[model samples]
Target chain A: MARLKIESLRKSFAATTAVDDFSLDVGDGELVCLLGPSGSGKSTILRMIGGFEQPTSGMIRIDGQDVTRLSPERRPTGMVFQSHALWSHMNVFNNIAFGLKLRSLSRGEIQRKVDQALELVGLAGYGHRQTFQLSGGQQQRVALARSLVLEPKILLLDEPFASLDQHLRERLREEVRDIQQRLGITTLFVTHGQDEALAMADRIVVLRNGQCEQVDAPDVLYRNPQTEFVAGFIGQMNFLSANVEGGRFRHPDFTLDVEVQDGPAVLALRPEALRLEPSDSPDAAGVTRATDFGSHIMVDVELRDGARLKVMTAPDARWQKGQTVRLAASAFALYRQNRLLARGGLPVETVEGRSRHALA
Target chain B: MIRSYSSTSGRFDWMGLAFAILLVIVIAVPLLVVFTWAFTEVWRYPSVIPQKFGLRFWDQTLSRADVWEALFISLRLSATVTALSALICLPAAYAFARMKFPGRDLFFLSFLASHAFPKFGLLVAIAAIFLQLNLIATFWGVVLIQLVGTLMLMIWIPVAAFQAVDRRMEEAARDVGAGPLRVFWSITLPQAGPTIFAAVLLTFVSTFYETEGAWLIGAPQIRTMPVLMINFINNQVVVQYGAVLSVILWVPSFIALIFARRVIGTGSFAKGFGA
Candidate 1:
């Protein structure tokens, strides 16, 4: 295992930049996921780290050794592509043994290593089978084995589970994580999947438009997103436009006294943070719709200003169309110019004061 | 959509059966007549079949020194043309398929220019040049002219085959510690081998039957079988000599077709054309 340091990595095509000044330091044996939507340069960064693509500028070091200009064969890195990329001309044994044979290993040792790799992938007896004869999941296992058999210091996975069905993707990801932990291989996974990143990565790097948005643990990213984009991208968030005037954030349906410069702002509220209660006042928000999702009910509420928002609450038969209700956010983030200004609604005084101010 | 008539319930497919019969008769009848003519000592128009069938012309045609020389020349010219064209075109095809260089597409399209015009006119122009260089009636002169015809098949089919190879597989090989050359030999070439072999077989067969270039460039001094067969057909009073030569010319093509059947059965031959 080895630590990977990417410093100021930049890559550009002829006209546009793919990755812009991207930098990250992955600890030894840590699986850091580069998470983003399409065209966010996640794959470009992974390719640079794997030596598939050269960076337009910057340095990549493995274990403090500069390897930015090394070829893929010379680097201590192995990659698993999304297509499984198995050599169709070779059988499973030969595919896994290809790199070993290239290293001029003895025939008996190559055979032993290949057998051991197949067993590790739970396909102990499939050495002689052609890659085309295997199922999609089995083929992916063979791909994983082919990379892992090389015993590289760094493993690069470029959305290896993207093509798999949901059930199989979950199972294979778990298996891969288990193997990675057992071997303690430093892995950098690139994906457009949020749940996969959240479930598999020790630290997830959320990217947007070829720049780093936020890099943190999954729970921290969910609970304390530092930007409006991160708040919206990571989980379900209800963005309510408000005005921050004289240190008091003002919305049509609510207001909160916050420590911030007065300007236009947004109240980014998580669905679970919002609660609803039946109210007799006609000016209170009206429920437009409610969906029963087995464990919780999602109530769509329209405030007095006709802005709609979703509130997640315990299953309640009373949350139906045209039901008047008062809304309350247990915790919410206040943003100004797309940047987080304050996270309020924590203390009892603040939560109660916001409601009192709204009612006034 | 119009549904085709189904033949699944043991019903007779008369249209299909008629088409099959017509295809066989159209293709096989001339071959049968040629074979008959090759063995016939005498045959008159009034007789439905030959009055007597024997190998008289086969022995006669096989006995001539010129005929043996023509046969040997034909084989040598075809082998040389096919090998030389393969050496020149395969790498060009690979570069056209994989690289991103200036004028790559234009250069690739120019290979078609050889076959785009009337072939005889092009051969005449080349033969004029060959005469000035004292290359006329030389074996290499004939090989050069025949090489023109091979450019299309040798480059086009193999380009499609090489383009069909998955780049990700090569990248995966590189990731697994193989260098660029090793990846190409182990991953790229093997995947594209069958279709390339099919292209070679087609090139060989076409070169073997190439007549116009051989007749135009290698007249008088170097005579291929087709050139000799054309001579016999025009001058010889005995019909069997030409017929026997026709059957002899068909031999290599028939063997090539058998190999082509297997190659095409694997589906790579047609796949080389984006099938």
Candidate 2:
């Protein structure tokens, strides 16, 4: 397995940059997902890596060698497309053995490898069936087997489970992750599906408008997003405008203390992070519980300046929507995640190159 | 929803039915007469049906050296012509149908525009060129002329057919690691099956019955079915209405048309071909 490094990779169409000047390293045997919404440059970056599209400007390195101009056949990377793309004319056995045959492997060896790949994908007995005769999931397995048979240094998947239903998607995702981990193959999975990325990636690179907004483990990304974009994108986030006053911040109806000064100039909290309590309780503290939204309770209360605010609460707790309550995120944590997740919003820490600590 | 009639149209007339039936009889009368005359026996002036049914004419044509030679030449010529023309047309038709070259629409329109004129109109000019090239009276010469006149017809019909196929097939093929030629071979050519088949059949029929090109550039010894049929009518004193020439010339084509018909009716032939 090989590590992949991209430096200032950029791809642009006529009036838009599908991928901005972005860079990230995928270590050996590490699975990194380029996760974003549609048009966020996730697939474009994947295509650039797979040699389908030429990057406008960038250096792509595999292990340590630059592969900016190598053809897909010459590349040591295997890619699986969202459409499955199994050859309809070939039978199950031939489809898996295609790459090995191309490399002029001996017939017996090719057959062995094909059979092994098929068995790995759990389609061992479908050797003679035509690709078109297989079901959607079966065809997907065939494609996976085909790529896996090559045993490249790295594997790239572009929304591999998008076409499947929810149940099938879940199963296939687990299968792909399991196969990838078992082989210890470095993989780059591109998808607009955040759930897919978060569920499987060793580190999730959440992209926005062609630039990387944040990259970290799933829990870190969800608990503390780096940028305002990441904060809004990862999951449900409720943003409230507030003005900082020395060590404290004042909202319309709530006054909270910030340990630091100005950053993104906006305060944001996830629905699940904010706890709720009864507004009229004599000992009301932290966020008060409010509206019952079935899955989770939504709390409505007043800010310091009397403006209304809503936060999420646990589903088991009883809450009402219009009641007033206090809100505190001390337990929610400020910089518990990466520095990007911190409110100071400065370059508090850098993962690549040398670390530059903020002199708070 | 407005008030619309379910059982009846706004205007329905018994007179329309009578008129339509009358139209069918009028149109079918001439074809029925040709069939009647084709089956009839020898007659002094006129005869509605054959005096007696016999295989004399059939045997006569079957034994004739010239008729057999014509049959051999026609079958060989048509087979080669259809195959060669399809090879040239299929790729061009596919390109026209699926891609956007600089002058694609213009070139396709020009090819279709040639269909407006009868094949005979270009005979004089083509003959002059053929004579200058000293190609007249050669089998290859006649075939070449037929290829030119029928190429556009072969290409256009199939181009339209390819255009009607699902556009995703090509994109999918390419994404699956197939290059341009591979995609065409596996996905494109097969998916355009029905239209291509119809084109091949139409091209074969047209070239088989071709008189102008074969007559202009072909040798007397290399006459095709229609060319020989014309010669018989023009040169012979006693009109040869025997079944010999007719049965020998038309039967083979009839059999061929049946094979072509299967391809035209349904596109099941495309199954193994498309990846």
Candidate 3:
């Protein structure tokens, strides 16, 4: 295994930059995911590291050796492309053994390694089958086996499961993760699916507009996003525009104590972090809609000031539509100009008394 | 049920029958006349068929030394011209198909322009240049002139073939430790093999039958079969000699057509041109 370090890497096509000043450090045997939507430069970064694309600036070092100027064949990196580009002229065995044959390995050795790689991808006796004879999922397995047989120091996957069905994508991602952990090869996976990144990557790098938005572990990224884009992109977040003065967040319906300057701020709260209770006070919000998700009910509440919020609560008849419900946030993040300023919990104050709702 | 299906499907097709008759009158009648003349000892005007049928002329023409020399020269020139065209044009076709250099489209258009005009006029101009360069009446002169005809077939068809090769497959080969040359051999060439083979066969057959260039450049010394056939038609009194030469010249192209059918079925041949 090798540790890959990319320092200030940048790529530009004639008039536009695809990736800009992107730097990443992946430890030995760690699978780091570059997660973003389309045109986010995630795939460009992976291609630069795989030597398929030359960076306009900066350096790529693998195990303390500079490899920025190396061609794809000279680099110790193998990539599984998005289209599973197996050669149609070759059968499964030849497709996987092509690189080994180029290295001039003996026939017996190449056969043994190809068989072993096929078995590792769960296709033990499919060597003689033609590549076109395989299904979409099976073709991807052959593509994976083709790259893995080279025994490269680094493995790169560019949305390899983007063409498969939902179940197949899930099963293949799990299998790929299992094989990567078993082989302990340093891998960089590029995906637009957040769930895939969360399930397969040791750490996720969220990118936006050719720049790094946030990089953190899965649960940490979901629970504590550092920016408003990350907060909204990672999960379902309710954003409310409010004003802050004298350390008090002044919403149209209610107010809360905050630790920011005297200016307008944005509050981002996750659906499950807010609590709902039936009430008749002027500060209460009317239930617009409610959906029961078997384990919990997702209630959409619209405040009197025309602001809407989604609150997740247990199965309660009082959380239905037309019910005036008082809202309380167990946790919230305050943002100014799309940057997170502070995060805290708020207590719900009712006619009876002030009570803090602790959510699991 | 099978009998009824056949009867309905095979109902009399007058259009197809008319086309078949037209084809026979246009193509088969001349061939029938040639074959009959090659075997006839005597045939005269005002008669539908030959008065006497024999192989006397065939025996006489087969014994001629010029016939054998012309056949050998035709085969040798076709082979050399085909090989040289492939050597020079395949790489240029690939560069035109895949590379992004300045004036590439203009260069490609120029290759297409080789076939745009009356070829005899062009050959006369080229002959003037060949005469000045001491290339007149030389074997290499005929080869050079024949190479011009092969350009359109050699460059255009294979350019389309190479353009149709999936670039992702080449990148996959490179990603798996194959260098640029290795990727081309393993992936790109094999995918484009059938179409390129079809182009080579076309170049060979066309060069074999090429008359103007061989007649103008290799006269009096290096005579190909088509050049000899033209000479026999112009100078010889007997008709059987030209008939035998025509029959002999049709053999290579007929065989080449059969081979072309197998290499690229009619569908893909059309697709190669479509691109």
Candidate 4:
């Protein structure tokens, strides 16, 4: 059982700190993805775990052993790089056999293990093919075989799918996930692409500016981002700046009783959660000319006071440019904080649980 | 068919052909003349063709101690110098090419600075230093001085060669559980083999034919080939000059030249020197 616990890890490159007070735990058989943009320290944390880099301050314990100061070869871990660093001079078989050779395994044993690895990556009978002669996808398999042949306790992957084409990326992602599950290895994967992280990882650790913005299972992180950064980074978030006072939330020209702050607050509304209707009571308004973009229709509605509210309608709807309409977002209960980004006991009481009577 | 014919149609220029022929002749004629004269019995001046061709130069030159000793010393000294220089510079070259450390560029620039002085200007001082060290007539002195002087060229060539091996390859090897030494041996050194071979060959050839370094600081007991040739020519012995050069020199140089094409390359040299 390779249970990894990283405690307050920090890494600095001279004056530039790449990872700051980062901490996480990966239970046995968990596949965790460190998701972030470039320079977000996602890759750096993976490197530190892989033993390729030393954290400025942290404790890395694997199955209760501190392996932070160990070299990569000494640590019970295997890593695949972004470029699929296969040995060009060696054939597929020999490349994968390198680790076995280092371990002083018998030639027969090495051959058996190598063949098993090759077939595992679906490159059976390709043992003699040189790495350069293989296609990009095949070369990626060779790289995978090279690492899987060792079957280390923890597997670290650093953007391995970034170079693969879209079709191959999809296929290989499934293959990798299947293989990881089959081996039951604890894994740490790093990627800047959210879709890849969402598709492959059991849990996603969203990072920004050398700090952990949030760490939760994919659905939780996506649905309940505790901070604005997490909400914005995960996918599309339609932002509306408003104020909360007198136990009520105030949108421009509208107000409703809600349990929230008494000062400035930003509401991140997903476009799909917004609703539209004809303004029979004259409170709702939407647009006409800015309609019908792709499968959805984007309408801009102007209030009598000239404040504009935008809403997306289905493509089948017949909303045109000159029409004025009613617009209202879903209830306040529809949105939630992204807890991965929550800083403290920054007290987040649920909307229904609190005594605010209506919505915020 | 129309597209194929159009693609096949081309232009020709006679002036370009004539100029190319002229350039080839201008380059090839001198080398041809040298080889032809070395093979013929035409030791006298002003002869378009030899009146006779014989093994007279080879047979006579084989008996001369000075010629044999000089050629042997030149070959041995060059081999020793080249080997020593490569051994000393290999690690330094790898560092300069791939590693990042404090003041690397400044330290590398210091190695190149020794070549700033003209060889002619340093003849007297080199001679003095050799005398002080009692290396003025020692074979080790020739090898030592030649090694230091040739190191810049040798190190720079391999440095550029190693730099061309792509740092990503090294990083890959390291990621795959290879240590620093293993990375160099398996990745960097293999990639740089051809270029390093060429560098060593060039250094050996240059040191073998070096006239100034041998004359200024070499021991009379360990005479280099060029010094031997010059002394033979200065002795007013036409037959001896022919014998010493043709038999004692041309064969080995000709053999080396035949294999020189292996070391020299065209576009692929970009990977050697690193664009």
Candidate 5:
């Protein structure tokens, strides 16, 4: 049985719908990420699960118990806020011990639990330090420890690393994932950052306009996004308008044979899926604007018709500015409007032999 | 270079020094005169200073049965008013700071409007209402009137203080299994400590110095220190006794100001509300 099940949850504030028809089931010990840009209702879903918000029309079941109308304090979920929300007046030890104390645990048990939580978050001896005296990363750990000490039925983190610097954020992302896995706690993490979601989550739920756009594993979300929005959002993609007639796909600069239905479609090409080679043909002429980032190079090509295509290549690859280059895709996803048509590695003959033959 | 330029300019600010000294003296001279008269045995208008100084007036005022009775009544009334206003305002302030209800801004503006209205103008109408309610000359009557007059400060200060408390802190507490009241006591109240302390001090001192409501609402049957002080001033022969009463009233307020100085100096209160 699913540890937590949310069915058709909707929340409307005044005339605006903040979260609409949201539904998901979190399995036992699964860490799911709600990923979206700002104002996408991901945080709203987390708040609803945490019982901070009341869904307009839906039911939430945790461990087979209805919890939709329950107040936050009555629920069995723990949440770490984006601000880390450490009690400024309380020391780290007291902040971590707060939930245990509320549960009316024995003094000795509370102490043991708090100490274990501190160790789990790697802040074992810093319990007595004032929360404000700690650095941003330490404060975030205290927030995590505070929630984890409760041994709640579920853990909800609302962009917990948003306040930290990039370096600290990356480190804590791994630490939190490790801790969550060790405890095997059912967890829901909310973040607008795609990298954070991809790095930490076992599954990603993409939200847009108060609804779930797609829910899949990180690799699946990146490789085979079912929608154009998901394709663009999860990773970088170059969208090119093309037409398929009798299994031949034709674009302004290139043509190839593909097993696609005869119609107009948009091809979503990942930058890494394409390559650039110097060309003398006027039709294949393009200028190279390459940006080197040590590990890889991102080359942006401006075609003669004013279309910009990006291609990612190895750091050793060299291309001069204003050089004419032909573009070829090793793989791409085809979409008709917002609907997906085909996706995968292109046939070698279709990419090289057919393109060269068509150009000649 | 800028530091040297500022330092060089700072040396010739004689006019600024003069204005500060004048400001202090202007404020201190009245209290000094009141203190001097409270202990003066004999003085004439043309003397410019007292010819004789003793504690005769102070002793006479302290020995009076009515004077001590008035002092006790005044202390009790102010204390009750301060407590009652806090009980009413703390929740109202929290609501104004944290919750969004219909007409919230209008409700808050009403408090500001009540504070802006001159207290003296409302005294007569308030007295009439108290008289009809059979609350005239009652201790509770004076307490009620003082609560109304001083509630604006009690509420406004804490509203800002509570707003300064991050909303996420309260939510964190709730997520940690704390109920609403527990979250308030453990998080909200402690975060708002300095402001609440300042509010109590302001409310207590204001109520302690209130004369209009005390005199108008609790005159003969309930004689507060201010009412007695007014009585002493009304009598030409015993006019100096008013100075003794003024010193008596000033003592608690002075102590409160000293305490407030420490709290406000912590710099938390100076950040202002909604900061």
Candidate 6:
């Protein structure tokens, strides 16, 4: 295992900047995920780290040794491409043994190492099968085995599960995490899927438009996003435009006490943070729709001002169209002009499971 | 019940059957004529079949020293040209498929332009150059001329073939610690093997039947089968000998066609094209 340090890396192509002033330090034996949507420079960063693409500026050091100018073959990194990229011309054994042969290892040694790698990926005795003959999931395992057989200092995965079906992707997600932890390899996984990043990484680095937005533990990033983009991107959030006046947040439909300066702001509330209580007050919201998914129900409410909000509640909470409901947020993050201002739990006043708000 | 089912499904369409028979006759008649001429001792006008049939012409043609020498020259020249064309085109094709250097499109378009030019006209100009260099009537001269005519096929097909291979496959090879040369040998070349084989076969057959280039450059001294066949046909007295030689020339092409069919049937060729 090795610690990878990237300092102020940037890549530009002609007129477009793909990755700009990006930097991160991945600890030894830690799997850090670079998470972003398409065109967000996550793949470019991964490619730079793998030595497949040269950075326009900055340095990449592994274990304190500069490897920025090294070619991919010389870099101590192994990458599993999004397509798996198994050699169609070679059978599974030869595909995994290619790197070992490049090192000029003996026949016996290559065979043993390949067998061990195959067993690690749970594909023992599949060595003789042709790569094209394998199923999509099995082809993915062969790709992983091919990279793992090299025993590089770091393993890079570039959206490896993007091509698989949802069911197989979920299963492979757990398998990949298990193998990474068991081997304790320092890994950098690039993916656009939030769930994959959250479930797989020790820490997630969220990127936007070639810049780092936030980097933190998955749960920490989800609960305490540092920017408006992160707050909205990490989960389902209902954004409400409000203003701070007299130490309280004043929205068109409701007003609540907050510790902030008097200025324009936006409040981001997660669906689980909001509670919906049936009420008959004139300020109450109307339930437009509700969907139950066994464990919880997602309720959509439209206030008197015609602004819609999503709230998650217990599955037993029955709601119907045209029903009047009062909205209460347990926690929220307030931002001013895309910068975080304040975030915490709200002290809501309630009476018999209903929010106590005066009707307008 | 089985008879009733056959009667419904196997109802014959007379028009389709007649078209199939006509197509077979159109293809087979010329082949039958060639075979007959190879064995005929006497064939005159308005005779559907030869009055007398024998292998005298075939035996005589096979026994002649000039015939065998011309056959050897044709095979040797074609093999050399195919090898040289492949050597020149493989790397060019790879660069066209993978890299984005300036003037790449212009350079590829030039190759297509050369391919589109009339071969006989180009050969006349090339023959002039060969004469000044004293390359006329030499074996290497014929091979060089054939390479110029056939280079486009060798390059164009393989460019499509190489482009069809996913770039990720090569990247994965590099990621596993294979260098550029190793990656090519283990990954790129093998994936393009079938297409490259087809190209080689195509160049070989075209060079083998190349009458114009060989006639223009190596006719009097370095005699290929096509040149000798042309000479025999120009003289009506030895037309039967030309027929025998033509049958012999068709053998290798027939075998190559069969081999190409098997290679194409393997379905490895054209794996990536238009995918």
Would candidate 6 be rated incorrect, acceptable, medium or high by CAPRI criteria?
medium
Across B194-235, the per-residue lDDT of candidate 5 in tens digits comes to 878888888888888898888888877889887888888887
Q: Write the per-residue lDDT of candidate 6 for residues A1-360, one digit (tens) a residue.
A: 799999999999899999999999999999999999899999999999999899999999999999999999999999999999999989999999999998999999999999999999999999999999998999999999999999999999999999999999999999999999999999999999999999999999999999999999999999999999999889889888978998877776656667889999988889898888788776677899999988999999987778889989899989998898877778878899778998878643223333342322
lDDT, candidate 2, residue B72? Answer: 74
Clashing residue pairs in candidate 3, if any? none
Q: Scored by CA lDDT, what does every candidate get?
A: 0.89, 0.72, 0.89, 0.75, 0.86, 0.88
Return whichever of 2 and 6 wins on TM-score: 6
User: Ranking under lDDT, best-scoring first?
Assistant: 3, 1, 6, 5, 4, 2
Q: What DockQ would you assign to candidate 1?
A: 0.79
User: Residue A195: error of model 6 in Å?
Assistant: 1.0
**Tens digits of lDDT, candidate 2, A1-360:** 789999999999989999999999999899999999898999999888887789999999998999998866567787888888775656889767756755788999998898899999999889999988988888889888888888888888889889989999989999999999999999999988878988899999998899998889989998767777777778777666655557654443334456766543466655555544344544343333366779876776554434444566677866553444545442222432234333533222111222223233
- Model 6 ranges with Cα > 4 A deviation: A242-248, A259-264, A279-284, A347-360, B1-26, B39-54, B237-239, B264-275
Rank by DockQ, descending? Answer: 1, 5, 6, 3, 4, 2
Let me know the DockQ for model 4.
0.32
The 10-residue segment of model 4 chain A with minimum total lDDT is A341-350
For residues A158-250, write the lDDT of model 1, one tens digit per residue: 999999999999999999999999999999999888899889999999998899989999999999999998999997898879788888877
Model 4, residue B206: displacement in angstroms?
2.6
Give candidates' CA RMSD values in order: 3.6, 8.3, 5.0, 6.1, 4.0, 3.9
Q: How would you class the docking of model 2?
A: incorrect
- Candidate 5 residues A1-360, lDDT tens each? 139999999999999999989899899999999999999999999999998888999999999999999999998899999999999888999999988888899999999999999999999999889998999999999999999888889999999999899999999999999999988999999999999999999999999989898999999999989998899999899887878988866765556666878999887888888877777765565665889999999999886557788889899999888887777777778888788988767621122223431332
Q: Which prediction has the highest DockQ against the true structure? A: 1
lDDT of 6 at A320: 97
lDDT of 1: 0.89
| Model 3 C-alpha lDDT per residue in residues A41-87, reported as the tens digit of each score | 99999988888899999999999999999998889999999999999
